[model samples]
Target: MSSLSILLVEDDTIEVMKLNRTISKLNLNHTVIEMKNGELALEYLNGDHKLPDIILLDLNMPKLNGIDFLSILKEDNELKHIPTIILTTSCNQKDLQECYNLGVTGYILKPLRYEEYVTKIEKIVAYWSINELIQKK
Candidate 1:
């Protein structure tokens, strides 16, 4: 499979570290672009750099929360096509509904266990990767 590029918008340093290790262990050919908040993610997306294949976004952030970012992104025609997955600690039904309403492709709750987290991320990656394949056929 071709290398997948992902934009990860997360503010927690510990989660970031754990995700990095999990990615390495999974042996997936991927590149992760990190941003501390949704605002920085928007800047990167709007810049000249190539757009990532997918985005994993967190809900709570210091500047520009996930829902706000998703709202803005979905409104912009050029940016709306990119797939986004909400990876957040929030299990609130309202938040989940809002994310889906904003057009998020998937929503995953942050698992407390490392193994569980790895499994969830792998499943997400696998689905996105294979979904692209099926679409091309």
Candidate 2:
């Protein structure tokens, strides 16, 4: 699979470190751009920087939560095509349904175990890296 440019919007420092460690351990050369909150992520996205291939979003945050961020993202014509996956701990059915309704590509519950998290991340990276994504001009 080709290396991917991943936009990870997460609030927890530990989770960020865990993801980076997992990626390094797997020896995947994907470029990760980290944002601590949805507001910061939006600011980055709106800037002149190149867009990421996929977005890994966490649901609960202090400012502009994932659902709100997703809502804003999907409404934008230039930014809507990027596949967004919810990498969250919430198992709320309403949250799941809402995300899908707003056109989220996937919803994955964060596992407690490190091994399980690694496995899930591996699969996620493998799948998205192989898929032909929409090329936003």
Candidate 3:
């Protein structure tokens, strides 16, 4: 599969490190851009940068939570097509329903075990890399 530019919107330092570590361990060449919060993520998205093929979003954040961010992103003309998946620890059914209602591509619960996390990330990257993604001009 071809390399994918991934935008990861998360706040926790350990979570960010864990994802990076997992990617490295998997030997995948996907490019990962880290954002501390959804606000930063939106700023990056609106700027003059190549849009990411997919987004891994965290539900809980300090500024602009994932659900709220997803709402704004979906309303946009240029950014609406980018596949967005929730990579969060929240198993709250309400949160799941709300995210689906707002139009997320997928929602994955962060596993407690490191092995499980690696497996999940591997699948996520592999799936998106093989899919035909849009290139916004």
lDDT top scorer: 2
**TM-score of every model versus the real structure:** 0.94, 0.97, 0.96
Give lDDT per model, in order. Answer: 0.88, 0.95, 0.93
- The CA root-mean-square deviation of candidate 1, after full C-alpha superposition on the true structure, stands at 1.8
What residue runs in model 1 are displaced by over 4 Å at the alpha carbon? 133-137
Report the Cα lDDT for candidate 1: 0.88
**Clash count of each predicted structure:** 0, 0, 0
What is candidate 3's lDDT per residue for 8-125, written digit by digit as tens? 9999999999999999999999889999998999999999999999999999999799999999999999998899999999999999999999999999999999999999999999
Better of 1 and 3 by TM-score: 3
Across 1-137, the per-residue lDDT of candidate 2 in tens digits comes to 78899999999999999999999999999999999999999999999999999999999998899999999999999999999999999999999999999999999999999999999999999998888773322
How accurate locally is residue 128 in candidate 3, as Cα lDDT from 0 to 100? 88
* Model 1 weakest 10-residue run by lDDT: 128-137
RMSD of each: 1.8, 1.4, 1.5
lDDT of 1 at 80: 89
Indicate whether candidate 1 or candidate 2 has the larger lDDT. 2
Q: What is the RMSD of candidate 2?
A: 1.4
User: How far does residue 99 in candidate 3 sit from its true spot (Å)?
Assistant: 0.4
What number of backbone clashes does candidate 2 have, counting pairs of residues 3 or more apart or in separate chains? 0
